[model samples]
Target: MSQGKSLEHLKIVLTDIELATENFAEKYCIGSGGYGKVYKAQLEHFDSSNWSSKEGVNKYDLPKRRSTVAIKHIFNPEGKEGFITEIETLSSCKHDNIISLLGFCDEGPDHMILIYELASRGSLENYFESDDKMTYLTWVQRIKICLDIAHGLKYIHTNTDQDKQKIIHRDIKSANILLGDNWEAKIADFGLSKIHPADQEASTLNTHTIAGTNVYLDPEYKKYGRLNKKSDIYSFGVVLFEILTGRLAYDRIYTKVNKKGIAPIARHHFENGTLIEIIDHKIKEEAYGHVFALSKGPNKDSLDIFSEIAYRCLVETQAQRPTIDDVIHKLKKALQAQEKSQKENFKMSLEDIKSATQNFSDDNIVGRGSFGNVYKGVASHANGHTIIAAKRLDRRLFGHGETEYFRELDIPLKYKHENVIRLVGYCDDEIEKIILHEFASRGRLDGYLSDASLTWVMRLKICIDIASGLNFLHATDVNQEVVIHRDIKSSNILLFDDWKAKIAGFGLSLVCPVNKDIDYVIDDAAGTIGYSDPLYSKTHFLTKESDIFSLGAVLFDILCGKQSSIKLDDEHVFLPFLAKNRYQVGKLDELVFEGIKEQVDLQSFVTYARIAYQCLHHKRERRPKAGEVVIQLKRALEFKVS
Candidate 1:
């Protein structure tokens, strides 16, 4: 193809590129590699409509639209060949898991720029780097990301059409996997990709120069300069180890042990049944043994299957490894097992729920909400007379119909986090809809906030518990959907015998649209008055941040030992406002509940207060994510323990 023909579709000019990048300013540089530098720039975007009338259209005309883009500037003469190769490779490839190449510029012999759709979160390597402070990827996220990369590779290896040729991505490392705004993984950096002939039976290439990252390079390819699709699988196996262990492919610790790389170390652990020993500490602490504990699916069994696949991919010979299709088939079966394992075994009949609640006697009632009343009961079944809390929905309420009741039951039943209320069973019949849960002996968190007997240590623990639950809900690992607790407050937090806080009341919850990378919006803001986010109430735009704002109110309630609905006067001064005022004036200690004031460490209290204040930021973007809040609360708990 001629340069003019390629330029026709790209329609980018040198002036627009220079203006967007500020004449290649250093400040615009986001990353650099052996080839050249990558710059982030805001450029004018043209739609099909803008170029529809070709009679009046100019190639350089501004479209009056803007979008963020990444620009790669190639400095090496050899790099120019790679840049052109990437354009030729990506132009014909279109997949959701593959990064899109928007356009390219070839100006003389020294300057070549490739434009790609910006991946806001950058490369996957950034998250695993030693100095990275971002929250660790949850187990479900790691699995999904691996599946996504596999799908992309499957597409590359399979013949999409007779016209499209097969290609091998030589560099399939974490650094080449970019994350978009919704955290979707996209395979990127095709500079080192090799195209195979249409008639090549084995799809193997022989070259004198061995290419790709050292730690992830295929042993066969590295030794004999033999390149094939399995080479990509080998690199992918190394990445799986990185994801599982949260360590580099080639770490100093492994080097010290003479293991040199992760593959050997992981194989040794897997063979000895000590794989769990080398698993990421966070996963072990929060997700081990309880495969269904973190999300609705994807447990230890699924992980074992994944590990076996990775192990097979790292075999010494190329023919011994499974093909991409075989890997996909095995992964799908593993995911199916994960989802099947998450199926709830307790499907009690209406008669059973009645037997448990003693025919809804007033004496058995433990609590009440706008839509329902909770009853304390002993459910007799396989587990045998387990103490339970049965929530009976009142049909008279506006939204307490069969659909709403099931929605409420579905949210709690899908989750398995320790801090989340456990759903025992549910009953949906003509007479009523009831959901049963594990009973909290100590009752709601608000009941104990004002108790003079509660210690500061206990209070800190409650905060951590609440944060953990919120973090789990906000996480996208649950069936690829994020749950937003539209109603979050102290009254909804139930405490067990040991004062472990469990979040309940999902009647007002919202789940992000399936497979979407956007937040769910509601017409009306539904939550307790003092705890509802003011911005959400005014704009009617609901998001996970709204839950964070509500949590901020809970934190304030914990500190001041005041009810969220309590007003300073008839004028209705909210609790968050008063707490913020005190916090900003350096008099936050004045707001600490009198009972725990003396017991609270000054530094710990300050840290807690600061995090809560940030959560209350009027701008949703300014508020800390639930994961960040969890980190800060854990740190505050440590200070208290010290």
Candidate 2:
């Protein structure tokens, strides 16, 4: 193909650019700097495959779809390098966290422009600069934004898609990062980027030039000129501290005192254990703001992990800095830790609980478990009036004793996730103990197992949700103890109006703080009869695998569209036994629920069945972890019909 035919979709003429920007009017220019003015306009977006080639691809054949685009108009001779570098760099890179380069205009030396998808919220630098914008960003959102940048950087560093070019963005700063309408982060500005041979190692690059914002520049790259991916990592570490401190790299305070910026100051504070002193007051509010409201803040563990990694990234030696991959992993772990403890957990008055549930009336009872009865009630909250489930502990009944009641209440308060039930303040006053939970409008997951309306995809999603909850439960805390929900069952899984599932009933859970190396605890056999692990029951030992066994039984119940056990010919036949026998005989399809049998894809069925069967493995050591179950169930859901 000739030059005219090469990526014609990405070749916007100078006249079209001029017309869109109203001949480069002043008002249309959203920003201008050392590079050039950036103008926002509604321009035609040319789809890669869309064309009227019969018309020979003229200006008249431009695609009809209009979109908001940011056109970077470069006229300065000094800005030409960045314009060319950005064009080459963005064209080869493709990722969700990277800004999209849509079209470009290079008619002559004086007329050059590059168009990009408009980031509505503009560059991330704006957030930290304005107190009003900073207020909108919570600590949780900040962590996510950092994770997004780390993911994009990883893509650039690894180049696993066979691009055959090791691209490095030397200018890694908040100003170069753009934020979308929903605060989705995208890396931008590749003006000073370099393309090295893909086969070369990270430290192979030896350059005499030092470029990038001064405060965010790496000391190793500046002095020794050892430019590589680690240089980018150091700069990113500076940006990370900037986010944590809510201060710009070039803040007057830093420029006035340290000259090298917050990097050295952050390192000193982190080493001396006074890092929290420099933390942004606004974020400190979010981190410790657990007094009221459903909107919660960051967990201490998450902040510790995040701050430690950020501090590590800014180490003086290039070798001490972590790779982009390590940064991504640590960021994900921090997000999970924060999300687990991010919720409104408080205490409620007995009078308010009584008012919500009509003095614990029998008519108010919506669910009855071995522990007590759950009553649906309406309560006033800071946001507005909300419906809740007030689980009233019946002291008269031989159910979960005081110890178990406290344990059940503590779990939801401390560990919060979408898949795990949210606690809404508890009531404990002189034998009147009750736990409030977010009400499940659609009732229990067991009720809809056989319903044809509950499609296979929905069932698969519910399975994933419950498994995720179980996985979250198994995370070892400070005590190095794992939580084993010994009473996992279909009935224990509550389904919301939207068919979302959450694990409930933690009264029988065991927070076993055994030796770190031990996986099981020697305890009295305990759990629901049909769903209990046979190994635990026989040997008087409980393990996380016991919960896995129970989860397997629940999976089979959902598959077979019935309870854990069925009475056949005057004998109780367990679903696990029937499933195993049928599975071994190569007839597991016979066990699929009739309502969803036709809807289930063969691959999906096989994947789901294989994992569920693995969970039912008689040998405790053979059982798959809850995380593996989550992964397989998601894969099964993916294969389901769209």
Candidate 3:
């Protein structure tokens, strides 16, 4: 058969039209979706040398070597020719992170094919969803994937010289992201993409399209039919949540409640920092502080970088979120911080960790929390590991006690989350719940907030991690209800080995909707003094924002540190007018020690302190939600990260 007639006689688009050419080879099949099947093809063009380089090629390898292309032959009888045009325009708008288009064949109306550069590793969906596949992506690589998507979006939305018009990649999902062999991410499948005029500030298309994978859809766009940069950001945020947690956008178990499955769970993780709990079990161990320390850090710089970038990208509000350009800048800064810190803190092998913990000396007791006590156990498990934390939970809380105490002890089990302290195992046979978690030898936020040992960047990072944990909690669903972590204070927020804060002490956590009032009776007032939400304490209704208020108190504590609740005349040297009655008035700043006060940025410091002030408002309604607090904090700390 002639080459031209052979291609025509294939009858590829129609089911009934038998191919005069060879049947579609099984090996060439890339993917099959509802619309049609995608076949891998080779199109020889400009540099045939790029094709002929493979002299040891057979028929099978012929197509593989000749400028690899993916041909999507549509079998949808209703598929319109406009689909081809849309694909053509999309193919023209090239991006370094976007799949390149060799060409497309639109010979006849019914038989249309869209071609794209082949990605050997296939779709991101396969990596995330397949049970036997690799789920363990290093935190650094995850950050890079985030940057790749951000760069692609920036390219599309900013309409750089290559793109004549600003493009909206309306469908930004893991499935649409293709992984190259080099692990570079390429944004693909722009079937639902829309082009907006460069001159227009905001324009809407796809009035009838209303398309997106359920898990990654932007709530704002889904509800309002709006599409913009924010929509893309929201979608990317969902993707980020998925990457961090290793959870699919949707899963069968969640389908009972709604078809749009994992969004609620994703939102929950985003708010509570329980994200690590939901991470793929295969990769859960890798998500902890120790693994992070061993692989990505010795200096704790990468934790700061990851926390800042991930936290910023997942901001609930689109307006408050950073643009892709801003995201790239922050990511680059994080990378640099990681590089700089590596020089200061050498990577510790697991053997080091084993040796450090083997001694288990009392002198190694570094810090402790409400649920457990931490010892600076040498990293006994492996070499090159640094001082590890052995968190032995109080067994008394679980054994031979009143049923209520046992129940209370079980609460922490429910919080088996990364940010909250990892529960390695227990020494229950000897005592109560002797849980071992990674130790943060660097001390709690309390130590650094007041010590002057932490830099402004360090303090900001601590606060961001705390916020992330809270955000995850407030957003997660527990007992089919959201959890309101009534206690969010400095002491309750523990610092990890890397000095990143993780929220702990869930004993005070109340399942949401059951007890909204903050003022309700507690065994002891649910939170630390001065940090409790005055409104919640009085009203007993603690909303999600109440936690925000408590976080605000922590922010204030971060700013003022030991100065948070000092009495004026206790010889503790309180700020002037800091006495109980006069302190709430004005002139409080004048009382601050000149030495401590000069180093702080009154504007920025006040902004943070004021957020705490609002959180402590006499009214619960006034306190911002955890999401809002996250946004505010990100904005306040933007300069530091930048």
Candidate 4:
């Protein structure tokens, strides 16, 4: 169909669009491009009684109710050709993953406009800018989004329609991928899209102008001036990296480290066995068991497969890269594997757990809290007999027994990590409430900190382990919930036979739903006095940084071999304050326990002390993320081996 004919078929009145957009208000504009700005507007219900239908009119019909729409107002005359091309391309194609062109307005050449379905969730670019929003996308969600883009691209590449022809979306960056409600990804911005001529023998289209974002642009296309479906594949590979790393394709930090775009850096790591090193720490921790495994086939982890596909797509030679169809197949298979691995058996009968603990015998009790007693038990199941910790809540002591029991159960069931305490099962009987956890054979870290036999290497390992566990809890990728361990004292750090640390105690933990923002307001501060964040106590606002503060105290306790709340004669000196003060005056080495001080490397000791000092900063924003702390601690641990 001709451009004029297509415009007539659209049947969108210029006056109606003007009224809907309030004369193209700047406040209503959601985004802008080289040609024009895209404004979000609500159009009045379209009445069939007042409209006439042509052959193509029914296809572009609007809903009866006031519906949200995006109106692109083309201002530049040079861009009019691009606008017409977009209309011609989108009007011919109809895929669920492709953005729908609702209507068009061509009142005059200067006042040209095209209407499209509103993507309420905005573009994928917006989510990457902030840590809180990035947490909303899990490994599954990220894979699903990639699959959606692949399906749309597949449709464009393989369309057999004579009139439509094969098209290449020249700009396939994260900013062009619009997300609707539930984060359904749709490919948008067809301004730079190129249609391949049917008569041409070669699929590549030679263009004088270099279009698309530099970071995501294919190296082959940039150097050779050749554009094809593989260009889209290359750009999509960058998006895959963004999904995995939670970093922009051209992030300054990544560019500085690699001296090129993220693709080269990713490829280098992919060739090496250290791809896991560059993966977003949040997803890396969540995918620990499944991703890092060397096994293949049904036992093979999905993350490995996904990374391989991404690597294939990012090959320097365009022809060597996998097609969109191949990407779709691999992504689907990886998603299935991931889903299977995530399925867990977290339920247990009250009788089974009770029998395991000998009916909560006083002699079996391992530890006690204000509202509960933890008893060691042996439970036999399909996985064989395993030692378990049965936390039996005392209803008489705690007013909200059922709530606390379920809260403790809910968190553990949602997360699975080596450093995290696993919830084996739960027993919620009317008379008794109990939660079963994997028992730590060596008991709490506090119990063995002053044992005298513990070496500097062992202490460093424990500190690293604790940091890893805290990083997992504070990660946004795990259910998009930032878990703040309000009470992160030394007693809460449990140890296994191999001296591995597992963080426990979830009764006072607060789950800050990250879909909104980071800081959450609570009615009252709930934590041990010395270990609690001073900022949280004063402001009544809880955040993941508060947990970092508590971890700082634990780090000091590990170093000095003393509790945070211990009395110091006339006035009690909080461990965080004492450590920070001593470290500033170069007295940190003086506070180190005599047992490990002789073996501690001066450089490693100073690094550890610096991390703890930063965590205890008065300003929460100045504190490093738990993941950053993990990296620093790991580096400090390496000093022992050296």
How do the predictions measure up, each by TM-score?
0.58, 0.58, 0.46, 0.53
Model 3 deviation from native, Cα RMSD in Å:
22.2
User: How many clashes in each candidate?
Assistant: 0, 0, 52, 0
- Model 3 lDDT per residue over 296-355, tens place: 322245544554565665555657767777777776666556444432232333343334
lDDT of 1 at 42: 76
The TM-score, computed over Cα atoms with residue i paired to residue i, of candidate 3 is 0.46
Worst 10-residue stretch by lDDT in candidate 1? Answer: 288-297
Clashes of 3: 52
Model 4, span 1-642: residue lDDT tens: 265554455557888887987888888898887777989987743433234444455534633434578888999998877787898888767776898787777777778888888887889988888888887777777787888889889889887676568889989989889886546688998988998865678988888889988889999999989999999999999999888888888889787776557999899899998887778766754531222122222224788889999999999899999988899889988887775655333446777877898988999999998758999998875436888899988878455566667668877766556787887767665777788888899999888777778888888899888888888777623223578879899998999999999888877887776445778899988899889999999999998999999999999999888888666677878978888888899888888888888888977887788988999999998897886687678667876678
Instruction: Identify the runs in model 4 with alpha carbons over 4 angstroms from their true place.
Output: 1-344, 397-399, 476-479
lDDT of 1 by residue, 448-538 (tens): 8789787888888898899888887786332256888888999999999999998988888877764565465677678888899998888
- C-alpha lDDT of residue 218 in model 1: 91
Better of 1 and 3 by lDDT: 1
Where is model 1 more than 4 Å wrong at Cα?
1-224, 232-344, 397-400, 476-479, 569-572
**lDDT tens per residue, model 2, 1-642:** 123454556778898888988899998999998667999987876643344352355655666455678999887977777877888788666676889888888788788899898887899999889988898777777887898888788878777766458778999999999986446688999879988867665544788778887888889888888888888999999989999999998888787888998998899999999988888888766732332344444567888899999998998788888988889889878877876565323667888788888887888899986667989888875656778899877887434377778877877775556798878778787768788888999998888878988888888888999998888677522222468888899888998988889998888777765336535556677788888999899987877899999999999998888888788689989888889889989999998889988898999999899999999999988898886688688778877854
Local lDDT at 423 for model 4: 77
Candidate 3 lDDT trough over 10 residues, lowest sum: 1-10
